[model samples]
Target: MQPLDAMSVFEKVSVADIPARSARRSKTTPLREAISALLPEEAFYVPYFDQETGEGFKPSTVAQVVGRMSKDSADYRYSVRSEASKNGCYIICNPKPSNG
Candidate 1:
C-alpha cells in the first residue's frame, strides 16, 4: 500500500464533522472527549507500538480512547498488524473507502 500523508488526512478532517457537544466546548475540553467526538464511524484507527519492545508509543492516548469506545459502539473499526520497517512505529487515522 502507498504511504499516507498525515497532513492530508488532517486537512480533510473538518471540525464540522465533530459532534456539536465537542465543537461547542472550550479549548480546555478533555483529550478523550475531543477525540471521541471527532472520530467518525468506520474510521481506520491504527495504534502503533515498539516493534521490539511491544509497547505503545506517543499516540497511545487516542488508541486507548478508541479501544474503550469500541466496546460500547459497534460503529468503530480498527485492526492490528505487524510489519518490518526501518521507520519507527506510529499510528494513523484514515477514512474508509466506500463499497461503491
Candidate 2:
C-alpha cells in the first residue's frame, strides 16, 4: 500500500482504509474481546508503546498501515488512537518532555 503522507496531522483517520484487525471499535467486539474496555477506562494511556523504552512514537501513517495490514491476533500490534480533547495537540515524539 502507498504511504499516507498526503494526510494532515489533524485529519480524522478513516476506518475504511484501516484493516479490521488493526481497527478496533471499543463497543463492537465481544465482552471478552475488548482490550480497550478492560479494568480501567484510561484510553489516554491506550499504550501505543512504552515511553520508558527506546521505542519511538509511531506516526499516524504507521498506525494506519498496521490497521490496514493485519488481523487482531495474539501478536497483533496496534496504536491507540489519540483521543485528545483539545485539537492541534498532537503527541510529540523526539526528545522526551518532563513534568518539571
- Find the candidate with the highest lDDT and give its number: 1
Which residues of candidate 2, in runs, are more than 4 Å off?
1-56, 61-79, 85-100
TM-score of each: 0.27, 0.19
Error of 1 at 41 (Å): 7.3
Error of 1 at 71 (Å): 2.3
Off by over 4 Å in 1: 1-29, 39-59, 78-100
Model 2 over residues 1-100: C-alpha lDDT tens digits? 6579975578678889876686665422332233323332222222333367633333453344435432342333333446445221122122223336
* TM-score (C-alpha) between model 1 and the true structure: 0.27
Q: Give the winner by TM-score.
A: 1
lDDT of 1: 0.44
lDDT of each: 0.44, 0.37
**What is the overall TM-score of model 2 with all chains considered together?**
0.19
